[model samples]
Target: MKRLWGTECAPAWRAWLDRATEQIFRHPDCGAVERELLDHLEDKATDLMRIFPGLTREEAEQRALEEMGAAEELGEELARVHSPLVGELWQLTRFLIRAVLVVLAVECLWLLWKFA
Candidate 1:
């Protein structure tokens, strides 16, 4: 499974979180929701690292994941409260637009390199 947005180094925990919350991305308030989730994770990681100064970023991330509860259960709960059918389509469109821009940027860079 792919890592969660902020858990790039903690694949073990990230896989669980990513699988659980994959559907939440379609929620209308996805930007707010994602920001909240990342903030929570950051706080948890900071606390873990403070307690164990020697802990690596990955280790802190795993500890934070453990405290955050199972991703599937949490995802279900959040989806129930937040997901909107029409909003899903809107969210998807926004994501696609962003992705296309990124691809265009990469292609432009590649072309510039070739022509230079």
Candidate 2:
């Protein structure tokens, strides 16, 4: 993925972001979360580089990822935060509401026809 810093991310960074957001339910939400994570990674890497001028960009990025901890664990936490159950429930509620509205519209049409 391309970084907000206007540079293409390394394959390792891409892989990490993938693993980190794989568990998120919604694809759009996953993208947003990934961007946020990438921003944090970039900030951390920049800070690291500033702190240690001897560190290469890749080295700083690697250290930033390490400091962020395990991707799997972060993924699980993100998954919980972006719960599929809530999204599913909202979808169901919308479907039910639309169904009810359709039923009422049909009934209104029927009444208008009968009373005409």
Candidate 3:
């Protein structure tokens, strides 16, 4: 998210973590308790690596990218909960894009639909 958002917003991100923990604590579901445990482990690992600041800049960028990928997955899960239609639309768009690419490739090979 830092790449899509901004690197300087890490403090804001920290605040988000606090809010999420509070939400989990308030949740009535049993699975949320497990999520809280997992969140605690993840935060500990992140803080562990963060405290030993000897990694190179390149390594740091790679770590940030990995973290962002995980965050994007989390964002998708949250989006699924709030706006499932948006998620469905994004899925449909991706499917159509792949179909178009496949159609163009077939046209390039023979200028026709050989299979059909």
Candidate 4:
């Protein structure tokens, strides 16, 4: 987490990023987006410190998060671009599909066990 600036900035940065981008993406995409945003935040914090000497790491990260805008606004914008139809329907669809596949696999395994 602090591999770049020698500061534990990841916890703060990730907390904010998760609150910001959590609802915009699905499982894998959400992890990717979080990593990307964390990298950006770390880079921004480094840049801020470079630009203004005397700025602490925490100060730089806070400024960067503020500059990134409110979480709700960013989340909504990302949701619009990534999933225009971000709702329970998508969640339900994925859940149902997985559930059916799991049930089928279980049934197949049961049949095999019974036959054997």
Candidate 5:
């Protein structure tokens, strides 16, 4: 089960948090992901802080794994909401343009109906 995680559960939690943090790099506007990651880090850090006295980073991360769930689980949860556009900015831009067009069309229709 631990091998199913990563290098080690100790490093794995940090790596998972880093990966989640990287999601912010991809979508800086994702408040939800950022909040979740921060909360997860804080909770795990506190748990580690409580369990082992003077815990190092490794010890903290390991304790985090026990309380915070697996990296795979975190990844899966993020994947559910991660609309990672990556280098597909063009597609995202196009989608935005289409959405704006629809809104404009709706507004135009509303104005015409009101005037008539």
Candidate 6:
């Protein structure tokens, strides 16, 4: 998944977030969810590092990932909540509305030309 605001993140964390967010149907919502998950992961890692002063940053991050459980399962649960069918329907509706507006604009322009 693409990182927001060009912020750098660990490769492992990025990979896990990508796997989890990929299951979401709506692309727009994926970014928000990824950001939220990343915040949680970072907070967990920070707590771990504080608790264990000797632990390296990478080690702390690793422990946090382990605590989060499997990415695929989390993704599947997220997918269910996001609803692929609803996302598809929303996309279709937006496209149809745009097309209708374009058609109406052209018809109005033609009518104005005919009257003028």
Best by lDDT: 6
The parts of candidate 2 lying over 4 Å away from their true place are 1-7, 88-116
Q: Order the candidates by lDDT, highest first — what do you get?
A: 6, 2, 4, 1, 5, 3
Q: Write the per-residue lDDT of candidate 6 for residues 29-104, one digit (tens) a residue.
A: 6777888899999999999999999999999999999999999999999888777787788889999999999999
After superposing candidate 5 on the true structure, give the runs of residues whose Cα lies further than 4 Å from its correct spot: 1-14, 18-26, 29-35, 51-54, 82-116
Using TM-score as the measure, which candidate wins?
2
Q: Per-residue lDDT for 1-116 in model 2, tens only?
A: 33342325777888898889889867656778888998999999999999999999999989999999999999999999888787788789999999999999999999999999
Q: Each prediction's Cα lDDT score? A: 0.72, 0.86, 0.47, 0.73, 0.60, 0.87
| TM match of model 5 to true structure | 0.40
Model 2 CA lDDT for position 65: 94
Q: Candidate 1 — which pairs collide?
A: none
> Cα RMSD to native, each candidate?
10.3, 5.8, 13.5, 7.8, 8.6, 5.0
Residue 44 of model 5, lDDT score = 71
TM-score of each: 0.55, 0.69, 0.33, 0.60, 0.40, 0.68
Worst 10 residues of 1 by lDDT: 1-10
Candidate 4 lDDT, 56-107, residue by residue in tens:
9889989999888787777777777667355457778999999999999999
- Candidates arranged by TM-score, highest first: 2, 6, 4, 1, 5, 3
Between prediction 4 and prediction 6, the one with superior lDDT is 6
Judge candidate 4 against the unseen true structure and give its global Cα lDDT, from 0 to 1. Answer: 0.73
**Number of backbone-clashing residue pairs for each candidate, in the order shown:** 0, 0, 0, 0, 0, 0
TM-score, cand. 2 vs. native? 0.69
